[model samples]
Target: MRAVVYDGPFKVSVKQVQQPKIQHPNDVIVKVTSTAICGSDLHMYEGRTAATPGIVFGHENMGVIQEVGAGVSKLKVGDRVVMPFNVGCGHCQNCEEQKSAFCTEVNPGFAGGAYGYVAMGPYMGGQAQFLRVPFADFNALKLPPGREHESDFVLLADIFPTGWHGVSLSGFQPGESIVVFGGGPVGLMAAYSAVLRGASEVYVVDRIKERLDKAKSIGAIPINFDDGDAVEQIIRRRKGKEVDRAVDAVGYQAVEKGGNTEKPNAVLESLVRVVRPTGGVGIPGLYVPSDPGAPDEAAKKGHLMFPFGKFFEKGLTMGTGQCNVKKYNRYLRDMIISGRAKPSFVVSHEIKLDEAPVAYEKFDKRVEGYTKVVIHPND
Candidate 1:
């Protein structure tokens, strides 16, 4: 078996590894068919998060069940399934509350568990020839018949619903205005979700023309932050005022004029500057308070220099953290199946398992026209 192994900052290698086997009575062994690299995986590749070296580097995955343990009854050896990024024990209190991302019974030290992500649980990543899924009966979403193209649903593991979660947190009403910072996959999906939710206007701010073009293709107003102040651009369009809802999809280490800054404050700063005074803000971007390789002492505290006074003065509300995938995955799946949504629009690259090394390099560098990359382990 082969898997994408994390070597170091801006490094990943496709190497032969021992195939995973069923280790628990409740487990199922899946022969991974399709897996996708996520922005979160970039955090591990860059060594910004706490990803362990040698672990596989994928989480957005779908596959065919090759074997099942004695206790795994609902799923069989030939079932097709989509594995959510977060692994949860169905009996946990948080799982019962639909907060599967913070399952109390699995990986208790953290909010939840995920495959091949930093600061997540001990689960091995899914970007391999095979993977062992614990609590398989509860964790895998059985795909409907005739759904051969599971690549689109692969986004269900994280980014698809995560983008929707960002929009949901904003509490944006129909005919309202919204702005999303960052034009990466998540930001693009967030803009798409806003359009589905009846937002009259959606503005996406980013320096990249390629991503901005994608935003425009999805009917979002593209604001080139590189041309001028993004806030001023939005204000000028909104008649000298900010929009109703603002979202920050760019987390730590945001792009700056000369280079990237290790500051979570940049996203918040943009939100405060572009959101209407009484409106809300949605922050789905990643933020770690402590990092072993932080660039500065202030960054070590995970605190960004935010304008809290302005946030308070304007009475703006905020929602942040990892999205609980279980809460909306089933519904989002239905949307895809029913032709109401299409997540594959953001997939910019798809390659075989062996091509991960090249894909990682280009994606980590934000190479032109590379937004999301999907890997087929069996390709």
Candidate 2:
């Protein structure tokens, strides 16, 4: 078996590794068909997160079940499934509250667990030949017959559901305006989700040309912050009308528009400044409680100096957390199946597992047209 193993900051390698086996009576071992290098993975790749060396690095995954444990009656061998990043015990109080992202049991003493992530749990990632999925029946989402849209279906594992969660967190009402910061995969999907949900208009702010273009292709108004203050640009473009809701899709590593300075809280500050009075904001971007790679001492301890006063002054409400992916995936999957959505439009590259290391560098550098990268282990 081969897996993308994290070596250190800005390093990864596809190396032969042990094949996974079912560990729990309710577990299933999946032959991974597709996996992705999530933007969040960059935090670990850059040594920002506590991702230790020798760990497999992928989380977004969909696969065919190769073996199933006896207790997993809802799924069986050969069933095509996609899994949310977070691992949850179906009956936990948090899972019962539809907050599987914070499920208590999988990562003891921690709020949640995600496959292959630094602070999540001990579960290896799916960027390998096989993965052991715990609580299989409850965690794995079965795809429709014939695997109609494998590329599109692959997104249901993370970004699609996570993007939809960002929109929902923003209190996005149909016909309301939304401005999403960052045009990366999740941000692009956030704009796409906003469009599908009937946002009167979606504004996506980013400095990258390719990302901005992709956002435009999805019927979103692309606002290039490189041209000027993104908040002012959006407001000016809307003829002085502020957005009703905003989403911070760029977190921790956010840079200033058209510059190299690390202003991690840039998007959050802009969102507070641009969202209309009494409007809402959502942050689905990854923010760590402790970032050893922070550019400053204060930030290293997770103390960002964003404009909380502005958010307070505007009477705005905010929602921030990891996306409870399972809570929204089922409904979003139906949208994909119904032809009402195609989150796959954001995928710009499909590479083999062996090419993951190179793709990681390009994506981390925001290479032009490297909007998203999907890894096909079988390729």
Candidate 3:
């Protein structure tokens, strides 16, 4: 079998690797059909994380069950399914409470686990011909059989639900206005989710015109931070009114306007500035405890000079963490099946497994039209 293997900083390759098997009685083997390269994957690809060579690089995955273990009962061979990036053991306290993202049993000593991500877990990623799914009954979301929603269904494995989780964390209410920082796939989905939830107004902030255009296409008002201060831009558009909520999707890799400089807390600071007093902010963006590529010693150690004084003065609320994917994937899946959602709109390219390396390069560079790349491993 072939899988996308991380070689080093700014490097990845699709190479032949050992295929995964049913290692546990509760496991199942899946023949991967579709997988996606997430922005978080860039963290590892750029050597910011502890990811080493030969790490299979994928987490957003969906496919057909090729074989089921003896312990699997509800699912069987030929079941179409999508597994959340989070690898939960299903019986842990967190998993029992539907917070599968922080399952204590999967990645011991860590609060959460994710497939193919550094420090997440030991599970090999699904960006290959086949993948091993542990606790199949709890980890895999059974999808309606067929290829009809292939593009959209695969998104349910990660970004779609993650975006929704960001909005939910903000305690958003219908008719409230929100601004989402970053216009990548997850950010776009956050804006889309806001629209579907009946937000009075949706604002997306990004420097890229392509991404801003996509946000506009989805009824979100796009704010190009490169043009000016992002908070000022949003406030001007709202006629001096701050938004009810904000979401930070850019995370620690955020760059300042008109510069290549990395500011680990740029998005978080902007969220504090643009959200109305007493309003809330949701952060689904990936922030790490350490970054080998950070620009400063403080950031290298995961410390940011947060605007806590302003945050406290404004009486704002904040929610931050990995998305408990299982908490929202099922409902979001039904939204896709009913045509209420089409996350595939953000998918700008669909390439074969062999093309993954190139896709990763372009996507990492934020090249125009590389908004999202979905890999069809078995195509």
Candidate 4:
């Protein structure tokens, strides 16, 4: 079994590794069909996020059940399913509250567990021939007929649900205006989700032309931050006032022009500058407590020089966290199946498992035209 193994900073290799087996009564062994690279994995690949060497490195996955543990009755052999990025125990207190992202029983100190990557727990990544999914009945989302043609449905494993989470966190109401920072897959999804939820206006800000163009094609107003000051453009668009809501889809390790490295104050600061007082923000971007390469270690404390005074003055609120994937996936699946929303439009490239190394390099560099890369493990 060849799996994408993390070697070190800026390194990965598809190496033959021992196959996984069901280790828990509630686990299910899946023969992975498709897996996608996530921006979160770049953190580990760059060694900015704390990830161990030799660990598997993919999270977004869709596959067929090869075997199921005794405790898993809801799923059986041969069922096609999409595995949520986050693993949860169905009966936990957090799960009961519909906060499956913070399930208490999986990783103890951590709220939840995810396949592969840093600080996420011991679950192996699914970018391999097979994966052992724990609490399968609760976490594996079963797909309906012909769902594979709807390759976009697999995006629900993370990006689609996450994009929806960004809006849900923003506390949006119909007709409110939103400005989404970053034009990555999640960011694009966030804008699309906002439109689907009836936002009066949605602004997608990104330095990349291709990404911004895609956002435009989807009926979103594209703001090219690289063309000029993003804040200025957004503030002007909102009638010289702040937007009703803002979303940060750019997480840690955000880059800037002129080759100057700095902490990600752009998204947070823009949220403060553009979101009107009394409005809220939804931040689904990956913020880490520490990144070795970040320009300011002080900023790594999860404390940024945020506009606290303005935030308080404007009576603003903010929501931040991982997407409780299971909570939104079922609904998103229906939306995709019904043709109401197509999240797969974000996938700019499709590659084989062996091509993952090259694709990852291009994406990590934030290269032009690399939005989302879907890796077919079976290929």
Name the candidate, 2 or 3, with the larger lDDT value. Answer: 3
Cα RMSD of all models vs. native, in order, equals 1.5, 1.0, 0.8, 1.4
After superposition, the stretches of candidate 4 with alpha carbons farther than 4 Å from their true spots are 257-260
lDDT of 1 at 166: 89
lDDT tens string, model 1, 273-372?
8888889999888778786666667877785688889999999999887788878888989988898998898999889988889898898887867899
> In candidate 3, which residue pairs get closer than 3 Å at backbone N, Cα or C atoms, i.e. clash?
none
Clashing pairs in 1: 289-302
Model 3, residue 153: what's the lDDT?
96
Q: What is the C-alpha lDDT of each candidate?
A: 0.85, 0.90, 0.93, 0.87
Give the candidate order by descending TM-score.
Answer: 3, 2, 4, 1
Candidate 2 C-alpha lDDT tens digits along 1-379: 9999999999999999988888889999999989988999988898887778999988899999999998999998989999999999999999999999999999999999999998798899999999999999999999975657888988988898888889989999999999999899999988999998899989999889999899999899998877889888888888999999999899888898665988877887888888999999999998888987788999999999978787788899888899898998888888888988888898999999988999999998987577789999986
In model 4, where is the ten-residue run with the lowest total lDDT? 254-263
Range of the 10 consecutive residues with the lowest summed lDDT in candidate 1: 255-264
Cα deviation at 213, candidate 4, in Å, is 1.0
How many Å off is the CA of 334 in candidate 1? 1.1
Candidate 4, residues 83-154, lDDT tens digits: the string is 889988889899999899989988888888899867778899988889999999989998974445546867
